[model samples]
Structures are given as structure tokens and as C-alpha cells.
Target: MSSSLVVQDLGFAWPDGDRVFDSLSFTVGPGRTGLVGLNGSGKSTLLRLIAGVLRPASGTVHTAGSLGYLRQDLTLDTQMPVDELLGIADTRRALQAIERGETDVAHFTAVGDDWDVDERARAVLDRLGLTHVDLDRRIGQVSGGEAILLGLAAQLVRRPEVLLLDEPTNNLDRAARTRLYEAVAAWPGVLLVVSHDRALLELVDQIAELRDGEIRFFGGGFSDYEAAVEAEQETAERLVRVAEADVRRQRRELIDARTKLDRRVRYGQKMNDTKREPKIVMGNRKRAAQVSAGKHKTMHQEKLEQARERLVEAEEAVREDDTIRVDLPATEVPAGRTVLTVHARLAHVGHQVDLLVRGPERIGLVGANGAGKSTLLRTVTGELAPAEGSVDAAVPLRYLPQRLDLLDDRLTIVENVARVAPDATPNQIRSRLARFLFRGTRADQVAGTLSGGERFRATLAALLLAEPAPQLLLLDEPTNNLDLTSVRQLSQALEAYRGALVVASHDEPFLESIGITRRVTLPT
Candidate 1:
């Protein structure tokens, strides 16, 4: 069977008025491919379309395989054993039936070659870093990450012709992410993945970027896509300038032609003051003059219309091709000499380490899942408060939590930001929201209705509105819903920021790019 997927002119919208997909289209084959886009940009929706779980609003999706998808929406009873979730025994039978073309698409039953299925299922389970998950253990007893691994094992056992995974590495650690890259790199089947992990994208053969309601394919990896986008930005700026000038010139030419035509019409209307040779001659002259005037006016109007069309085209080029602006308005804060000092602070998980910070230090907190990373960040921010040791926070601090709870769920974005810092005026709030790309009419949209990325931005915008920027900024998984381009923009903003930067993220490149030189390693 051929291993490939073809999606054409796909689009989908929610019944509630949100547009989930807008003319998304792409093709994939039997190789590693990465799907990168902002959260709610329909990356997951597109995967569902290909998986046949969700139908497109108006397009065709053709798949050439027995499909398997690992969505984050996996629902497993906590009390169920992980082995049962894997369906190891059942998957074995399914593979056996497929091998002989014995099972119809409608149902599956165990008859022959059942033992072979078990062996294949075991091999797949082992490959997914689940070598230690006992086939008999209940999954409810394991971590969220572990449950996903079991789900992955169940899917891979089928040896599907096509596989679609969304946010597969979200709950994984550094080591687990590495193992996933290695596993897919050697796999021989069509793979479509949606992930925020840059490390994973580097292993893919092609990159499909979903942005601005369109899908654009780049032949190379993520690095290539970055460079290509940069080149495009440069080209777009140059073209916009050219278009602006041409539009102005066309408008001026159109005005000049209109002025000349008006003068001719005035001259024709005021004629007949001069004596004519005879009555008939005079009549003919009058008729000829009117005909000339009519043709001249018609041609002049046509030229004006043509010039106006050119201007429209130029403006469209400028509006549609402009570069994305990621600038953040960060204030230079007057921080205290000491931001935070941890005295022999021990993590709740017993990683067994002390963390100390002096002045404005750009630090990164990183560890595998189930590690004490979040716990440590909370300690630093005075949220959990050290249970066993002395902690000191010398400056005003603000924490950007992983799950944003600070934002008001019911208020409009403008109202929420306004409610946070009640001192700011409406005009000031409008100006601030615009910086985060929620300009004009969007400011009034309900905060709860916004997408993850937009919600994150709204919270950040409020943080910036503080009277004095928090001398210390603590961010938790800030890049989760952000696209790579948006992340780069945030990175640039952080690079320009002067206050202390404390970030907890799985994005190694983003941390490195943001000038994080020191590490407060959270214990595993």
C-alpha cells in the first residue's frame, strides 16, 4: 500500500463562530514531516481531518493507509492498567488480519497468526521507551506522560501506513524527546506530527507551516524555514515601499488627467463666440466638436479607472505581504540589588540542591516531567513558599504561570487588562493592548473567548501595565502556544529587556537565544 496523504482546499469552522481551518492544504509522504503553527491555528484540526475524526467543511482528504493518530485527547480511566490501554493483545490480532487481508474495514476478530501480533506489539512497546511498563500494570497508576507512551505503543503495534500525532512530546522530557526523534527517524511510513519541540522538527524531512490561514511548504528543515522567512520579510519590506510609491504616482496621474478633461469640457461649452462661414458650416463644426468632446471624456474616464485599479493592486500587495511585528513594550525597571536568595532551599521532590540569585540574573529552570521545575519556580516566586528553608525576595515580582490563572475569564480583553490595573485609562489600555497585537476592535473581545496564544499575550500585556515593571519576571512555559515566529519575537523582546529574566521552558534554543547564561537546574 502507498504511504502518503493528500489534503486539498480544506476548511473548517466552529458552530460558535470561530474559524478553525481556513483553506488549509498540504501533502505528505512516507517520511518524517513536522507540522508547526501557533496553538488554535488549526494544526491539530488538520491532523484530525486527515485522521477522519473530523470532516472538512469544504474539501477533500485522501489517505492511503490504515491510519493511527495520537491526539492529546486520549481518555484512559485512571484505574485501568496501562497494558489494557495499550491493547497489546488486540493490536496483535489486528495486524495479523491485515497481513492476510483477512479482516474487513468494519470489524476485527482473532482467528490465526495471533501469536505474531503479540510479538509485534511487544517490540513496538519496547521501542516507545516503555520497556519497563509491565504489561499487567494499570495505567491509572502511571503519570500522564506514561499513559501517552502506552497509547503510542498501541498505535505503533498496528504498523500503520500513516500516523498523525499532535503535541506528542508535550509531557515528555529531554531524554524521551530524543528517543522519539530516533524512533521516527528510522520508521518507514508516512508521518505527520504537530509539536512545539524544535529538536523534533530538525529530524523531519519537510516542514509545513500554518500561518495566516494558509499552508506554505519549505523543502528544508526548521533552520531553513527560519532563514527563508527572514529573506521573505526583507523582500516584503522592499516591495511594500515600491508599491507605496507606485500608488501615489498613479493617483497623481489620475488627478492630472481629470483636470485636463474638465478644462476641455469648459472650453467646448463656451465655444460659438467666433463668427462661422455659414449656418451649415457652423452646425457641422458644432456637431464635430461635440463628438470629439464625447470621445475624449470616455477615454479619459477609462484611463482614470485603469490607474485606480493599479493603486488597488499595489495596496493589496502591501497589506497582504507585510511582515509580522513581534515587538514587546518592556519598561526598564529599577530593580533592587537582590532579586531572590534561596538558602539551602530543598525541592519538594528531593533533587537536593540550593538555589541563590543576586541582582538581575537571567536564569532558566529545566527538568523532565515529574521533576520539581514548577515547584521550584513557585518557591522562587513566593507562591508555594519554602517549606523547610529561608527564602528572600528583595524586589517586586510577577509570575507568569504555565496555566494562566491571572486573566479574568468573563471580562473582555480590554476590561480584563483595565480591571487588573484600575489606574490606567481606557485610552492607555487601548494603546497597551495594541502592542500585543490586540488592536482596535479586538480589545473588546471576551478574554475567555481568545485562543491560547492570544490569551497568553493578553496576560503579558497586563503585566507590562504595572506601574513599575516587576524588577523580576518569572515565566512558566511561555512558548507553549506561541509559533516559532512569535517565539523569536518574544526572544527579541526579552533580549532587549533590562530586568531579571527567569524562564521555565522545554525550549532549549529559546532559552539559549534569550541570553540565559546561568541555570538553576530543578531536580528530577
Candidate 2:
């Protein structure tokens, strides 16, 4: 059978009674499909269900052929050898045994017809930019980016008919991303990927957006999907305006009809009181008038109800793109003020760096996976002392680490922000948190319970809302693991910041979106 994946009437819910999907269904043929959604919209869960990593509550997932899956978290035993991770260690051992003249049928069975498994594994590794990675090396010895690549390499070596990748480009640098992109572009199977990386999304043949408990397939890549959505929103907004006008017109007409009926009744009563016509004739006229008025009122009421329904439907069509909006005048530094200075060798990479930041300058810190970009950011924030130099900051600064560990997991979102801004009242903190899209009771959610996107927003809110205000900000891979919307929200939040910024990131598009003033690359 041709490679295909089909899901029929899929239903899933968490054990906590949180329903994620109900009767969701979609099919994938042999081509690249990029799955996208908001942070908790069940994209990952859907992929897991399809891959059989998680059992579905209901419905059936059918695959035509073999399947390979690369999960986002990529948890693995650090002590495992690279060959084992690549899934060729046993085959290689079997092949070696046969070469040693062992007359063992089990060894031949293990080897099968794949005597060149090691060579194929090495080729796949090399294709993903892991040429230097030895098969016998421990997984712990590789960088995080390399480990992600290795997982992909392992999947590619299996040559499955269907492949599912979730957030494959999370920690990959530009070069590694390029290599992965090439691999994705060349895949000849039913490939479905869940990712927030715009570049990776652009490589897909089509876009599948999971939203509001449903999946919507759009022709072409991310750009095409965006254009279609923009057009749809425009039409929806126009319809909403038309519906509102119709409702208003109906209301006015209803009021006019009521006024006319009241005037007619009063005129007829005055005439009857003056004995202008017989009592029976006047009574009959009054009853007929009452019936006419009721019909007119009911007609107008039905028209108004219909108009209101249309308005609601039109409004629903328009998507809500909530973004961060804030004004941080307190964080503004003087035009010529020295915000930060660092003159020392980075501890991890032993790279010499001399940097001076002034005013509200924005700097993008970029390097390979093991180039110590995080180390340099820590040194700038005084979190880690420089190996051979002194660091100075003229004003208060805040750091947002890659792991988003700044917030206290036990504390509520409001409490976390309040911890940083001690002088601000609970109400004051909540009012500001609203600008970060945490309104009402949402601010009361514990940090530990928040999704990846929520935690990023909460951490950012706390960082910017701190006491005395931060005049400088240091962010390490701030866009890592964030959804596309959250990344855009982060950019929106940073746009309002007046402080000097030193951001370490592998996401070049994000750095550009946030308007980086200059780029500094650390040596490997």
C-alpha cells in the first residue's frame, strides 16, 4: 500500500477531565505536512496519539507502513552509546561476530541481510552534521543540539514510510537547522512535523493548523496560510460591521412602529371620548389596531434577533491575536549612559570577549551549540564571575534563562511578580499582568502548572515588572520551545522595553523581529 496516515473520529482527554479533542479527524498522504497550533491546542498530543506513544481515548489511527517518531523532549539515557541510540549497536555486534568466524545462527539472525548498518548509520549522522560523532561515544558527551540531531539521524536510518517530528529545531543553531531542513526537504514519505520554527514550516508542502478542537488544512506553506487567514479576518470584520448596522436599523424601526401605534391609540381614544364615532365601532377599531401593533412588534423583534445572531457568528469568525502591550519608561537609560561593560574571558569556552553596552542598545549574541553563549550572558548578568575580567553594570538588570527557571514554581503568577516588585500592591501587579494576557483568575495559576508558553510569559512579566525597573536585560535562548504566537508576543513585549538588551538566541528571525542593533558571535 502507498504510505498514508488516517485518523477517524479521534477523541482524547486527559485523566484530569480536561478534554483536548473530541471527534477530531484528519488524514495525511505521502508529503510534508507542518502541524501548527497555539501552545496547548493538542498538536503534540495528536502526534503522540498517531505515533502510538499515547493511546487515544476513542477512534482509530491507521498507518499504511512503518513509522518513526522524534519527540520534542527527546529524553534518553546519557550512558547509552551513540550506536545504541542510532539503533545499530546489536546489528553491528552481530556482523562483527560473524566476521570473527563464530558459527552462531543467532548472530546471523540478528545481522539478517543488513551487514552495512554501521556505514548507513554513519552516513545518516554525517548528513545531519554529526560527522565527528563516534558510534561508541556516550550520548552525554554530545551537545543538546547534537543530541536532537542524533535522534533525527536515528529515525532517518530506519527509513520508515511515515515520520512524525515534534519541535525538531528547538535548540539547533543556523547550520544545524540548515542540515535538518535539507533532510526534511528530501524526505520521501508521509512526513508530519509539529514545529514553531518559521523556516522549518516554510519547507513543508502544506500547513495543518489545529485550533479550537479541530484541524484546518491549508494549501501551500506558512506564508500562504498567513495570507489566507488575513483575508478571512478582513471579511469577517466587514461582515461584523454590516451585522451591527442591521441590528441598529432594526431596533430603530421597532421603536418607530411602537411610537406610531401609541399615537394612533391615543388619537382614537380622544375621538371616542368626544363621541366622534359609535362606541361599538370605536371598540372594534381599537381591537384591530392592537392586533396590527402586536404583529408589527413581533416581526421587528424576529428581525432584530436574526441580526444579533449574525453579528455573533461574524465576530466568532474573527480570530483573537492577543499580544503584549506595555510601556516601560522607568527602564529607559540615558542616550550616552554606560549600561554594562564586560572585559574578560568566558569561563566555559575560554573565549576572550570585551564588550561595552550603552543607552538602550540591543545586541544579539549568537554562536554554535557549544560556543558558550549562555555562559557569556551569565557573566554579563553577574550570575557567573568572569574567568579573567571584571564586569560592571551601571543600573539594575534582569536575566531570563533558557530554562525559564526565574519564576518560583510553588508561587502563583501574581505572587511571582509581586516577589520581584515588592512595593507594588497585589492589585497593581494584577493590572500589569493583564497587559501580559494574564487577566482575572488566570494570574492566580501556579507557575508549576503553566504550559511552556504560559511560563515564558509569566517569567517575562516578572522580569519587566520588577522593583526599581530593570535598565538592562539579558536573555538566553528566550525563544526556545515557545510557540510561534508566544514568540511573537515576546517580540511585542521587547518592543516596548527601553532597557539595553543582550539576547542569546538561535532563532535568527526572532532576533530580527525584535530589532537587534548589532550581532556578536562567540568563538567555538
Candidate 3:
């Protein structure tokens, strides 16, 4: 068998908080791998650990080859020109000669070093879709998407044996994402990618799912892996049901035994006292009562142990209901066919960004970095006015910002909902939030410490109970940092929603799930 990256009996916990990974072990060889998990599930941390950026709290991460990591940090020197960053022809030639293990200058220059170095640099740039870029251009003026491509160029130049990418497709257009995926796919090295792009998952050979810091391997592409997960969940649900039934049965038997023991002991005591005939008869009755009492105690102990075991077994079947609930009720649509209008003119930040919504049309505006997608979203939601064009929303609109900042951080989820609809009584708000899975103390729990999905759910709770519900719902990147389950739940909720759904997201799968009816393309 070929050597691969291996982690054995690893356990890690944040010094400030709870443990994220415990006794986690896995192995990956030379192949395409997909790393998937919920937000804050340690996928990014694990990637960093593999890259040697973070030390494991226990155990070991061993690898047989050099590793490369593309983290979220992107820093470019705006003052330095491209040539200075990439080096001159002579420098490039010297670097290449050193890599080839040739020290003699005459030998290195004999085959026309300039031509060779230029060709090599151009080839790297071409592979990374940077052939058209001006080599002398400063990196600062370039867009974020371009910076990502440049980073890929640098990593490819090193030619590492193992590569790890952390959300490499974020803030990128379809063309850029395609380019990034192809580059990683073509590289003859072990690759592990953390991405939400469905297209990228198709290129992977296998997937590793991380939930609650535990990892489970799912062989094959996304489709196969999804089917496997669903099957496993079904099996887990069955185990829970069976264990619960056994616990009830054992409890009943224990209760029956205690009842019988009580009757026998009472009968023996009464008869012994009433007879008062001989010491032998009295002693026999007393001994019989003692035996019955001992038997009862043993049965009680057995029942207690059985109940504890059943609880553990049930937990083994499935973990806690960690699945955050996400459901919302949108307002009714206006009767007319055309519900909104955008007059054509220069928009916010002075651009020609115009849009319109008819009835309950679902529209998605897609654009490259710095193309004013957010600006347009803010304009439509009434947070910002266009520089020239005007947006006409027929009725009250509810907006779910990208960060969901509308929710008050200091209050409980239930409190947040109440404040949104001040006219609603406490009971009405609590009952409405309950439908969104915030019940009892959960509703009382402070919203500031909630997870991203939980915060999103809380925000949805507020939107639903608020008066004059937005006939139009505007969401921005609703699934960017969300898990697959959360995204799926949100998609289902939106699909069932009767109001107009306008979402701004880079996730193709999520967009399709929410039923995007119209699209507006933005220039790169």
C-alpha cells in the first residue's frame, strides 16, 4: 500500500472552551478528497493543523509528503509591481537552476536561461488563468477574485505533493470557480478541499463528513455520499425507537415484581402476629418475609441498571437534536401582476443597476467581485436609495441581511421576536417562536451566543411575527456559512413560503433549491 497522510487517536480542545475533536483518526492517500461539515465544526481548524499552522493538543498528524495550504488570508503588496513580486528573468533562471540541482553558472546559462525562465513563468500564469494579466501591474489594484487566482499560481509554482484548500471558491464567479476546480483536479498530487460548491464535490473521489467534531467517511461522489447518509440516519432512527420500547417494557416488569413482593411480605407479617402459636411458626414467617424483601431490593437494583443502559444505547443510536430548526412564514403577495418596479438610471454608488419584481417573482442577481450586488440588495430592501434609478416595492418588505444584524444581540431569542412586533403579546410571540424550534429555555436563551443557523432562525422568528409582514422577502447569502442540513431546511421553508423570495447567494445548489425563476447577470 502507498504511504498516505494519517492521524491516530487525535484529541483536541480549545483551551477556552469545549473539545472539538476526540480520538479522531483518518487516512488519506493520493486522491481527490472532499472535507464537509457544519459551520464551526473544525474543518478549517483541521486544515490548518494539517498545514502545520496549528499544533494538535494530543496524538499526531503524520504525512509522507510536503503539504501546501490555501487559507482565507489574502494579502497583496499594492506598492510593489508584479515583476518585483515574481522576480526578473535572471532571478527566475537562478531559482530554476537551483531547483534542478545545477550550480555552475556557465552550464545554467548555456541553454539561453532568459528564454527558459520566461516560458516557465508564462506557463504557470496560463495554467492559473492569468495569462492576460499585465505582469507589471500592482497586485493592489486587482480584485479579490484575481488575487485568489494569483495565490493559486504561487502554490502551483511550488509543486507541493499535498494541497489543502479552505473555501477556495468564496467571492468568486462561476468562471473563476471552474478554473480553480480544474487546476486542483489536474494537479498530480493529493488534494483535500473544503468547499460548498456542488460542482467541486463532483470532482472529488470521496467525502469526509464532520459533525460534532467526529468524522465519518463516505465513499464516492456527492450523490452516493448523500444516499449513504440518508440510509444511516434511517437506521439510527430505528435504533432509537427500539431502545425506547425496551426501556418501557423493563420498567413495567420491575413495577409488577415490587407489587407481588409487597403483598407476600404483608401476608406473612399479619399471619405470624395473629397465630402467636409457637416460636417455630413465628420464626418461619419472619424468615419468609426477609427473603421476599431481599428479592424486591435485587429487582429494584436491576431495573435501575437497565434504565441507565437503555439511555446510553439510545444515545449511541443518534446524538442530540443538534439540527437547528429554520422555518419562516412570509407575507401574502399583492394581487397585481407587477408588484415592484425599478426605473432605469444610475444606481447607488453611481452605477446603472436597475431591477423589477412582478407578482411574486424570485430573482437572483449574480456578479463578479465589486460589481455592486450588495449595493443593489440594500437598494431593493430600502436600506439604500439608488443614485439615479428608483425601486418600487408595493408593500412592506422584510429583509434578512447577510449577517442577520437586525436581531438584537443582548436579548433572548424570544425577546427579540417580541421586540420586532411590539404590538404582539408575550404569549403570542413565544408561541410563534416555538414553531421555529425555540421553546422553553431555548426561547429564553440569549441570542448573542447562538450559532449562525440559530441566529438565522431567530431572525426568521422575528420576521414571521412582525406586523405587515414583507410581501417580499430579501435574503443575502443565506447559506454561505450554513451546514448542508441547515441549507436544506431553509430551502424547503422558502419553497413552501407563499411570499416572493429574492435571494442573493453564490451557492448554485441552494439557489436551485429555493426555486430561482429569473436571473440578472453582472459583468466581471
Clashes found in each candidate (C-alpha, N, C closer than 3 A): 6, 0, 1
The number of the candidate with the highest lDDT is 2
**lDDT digits (tens) for residues 372-395 of candidate 2:** 888888888778887897888889
Q: Across residues 27-103, which tens digit of lDDT does each residue of candidate 1 receive?
A: 78888888887767788878887888887788898888788899867788877755456656455446556778775
lDDT of each: 0.72, 0.92, 0.74
Model number with the top TM-score: 2
lDDT of 3 by residue, 224-250 (tens): 888987787788888778777777877
Range of the 10 consecutive residues with the lowest summed lDDT in candidate 2: 378-387
| Clash pairs (backbone) in predicted model 2 | none
| Candidate 2 lDDT score at position 307 | 92
Task: Point out where model 2 deviates above 4 Å.
Answer: 103-105, 408-415, 423-431, 439-451
Shift in Å, residue 306, candidate 2: 0.6
Please identify which of the two predictions, 2 or 3, would achieve the higher TM-score against the true structure. 2
